[model samples]
Target: MPATPAPAEFPEDLTLGIRELDDQHKTLFAVLDRILAVSRDPYRQLDDDGTNTVLDIMTDLKDAAMQHFDQEETLMDQRDYPGLDDQQEAHERFLDDLVRIEADLMNGTAVPPVRLHADLADQLAAHVREMDRELAQFLNKSEK
Candidate 1:
């Protein structure tokens, strides 16, 4: 029997209290968790099938992130959020990093699945805590 993959942790503090953004965030983390499960064994390298699975998950993550960012940026734009530019830059950087990782994995370069998952999860959580938190506050205030 195969062992179950561990789910990625999304801290409570990372919650931005926006339904759409929060839902998207959960989707993003779930994708990352899938990666974690695929690479659950740190001592062993991923097999070809595992590599393919990770690649697919990466694509899904990127797609989800792009859609989420679009919605988020649109919201920010609608409200004239001052941090929109910075948020966009950060989103672009993250997508670029994902592309690079995908290329590396496709070219037979080894990227530890667990570490990759952790890094992605941490980066996203930090972004939510710092940037998205502010955006949430601004958005909530604007809605009032």
Candidate 2:
């Protein structure tokens, strides 16, 4: 797989007020960036050595995602946010899907790194634009 260049800049408007969640989001982006980098440089193919790095990054992303979701859900629970259940369900579904993907990758049944990287980037971009942005707005308004 050829290496893709990391975005010159991540979209700044995605920031949520929750510090930990925001940090985890940033870390997720960083992992995506690394994957992109690998995609752009074919020499960085996901072979034995590169596979571990990719898997490690993916694991980190999964962990961070779980933590962020947990924090968000807790905040929602504390405030009795109207959409808490729906949001939690979304988080659960995302984690389940991610875990499956990770398992496939580890088992050698998944697509190549470049394709996976592209898919993840697209998925995350859409997720931030829609779900996360809405969540942040909801929280902000609730706080006020």
| Highest lDDT against the true fold, candidate | 1
TM-scores across all candidates? 0.91, 0.79
The weakest ten consecutive residues by lDDT in model 2 span 36-45
- 1-144: candidate 1 lDDT, tens digit per residue: 345446766778978888889999999998888886775484356888999999999999999999999999999998999999999999999999999999988887766776787788899998999999999999999889
**lDDT (tens digit, per residue) of candidate 2 on 1-144:** 334544525567666666766777777777666754543353343666566667777887788788878887888788777778777777787788778887886776766666677677677667767787777777778889
How accurate locally is residue 139 in candidate 1, as Cα lDDT from 0 to 100? 92
Clashes of each: 0, 9
> Relative to the true structure, how large is the alpha-carbon lDDT of every model?
0.87, 0.70
TM-score of 2: 0.79
> What ranges in model 2 sit over 4 Å off?
1-3, 17-20, 37-45
Worst 10 residues of 1 by lDDT: 1-10
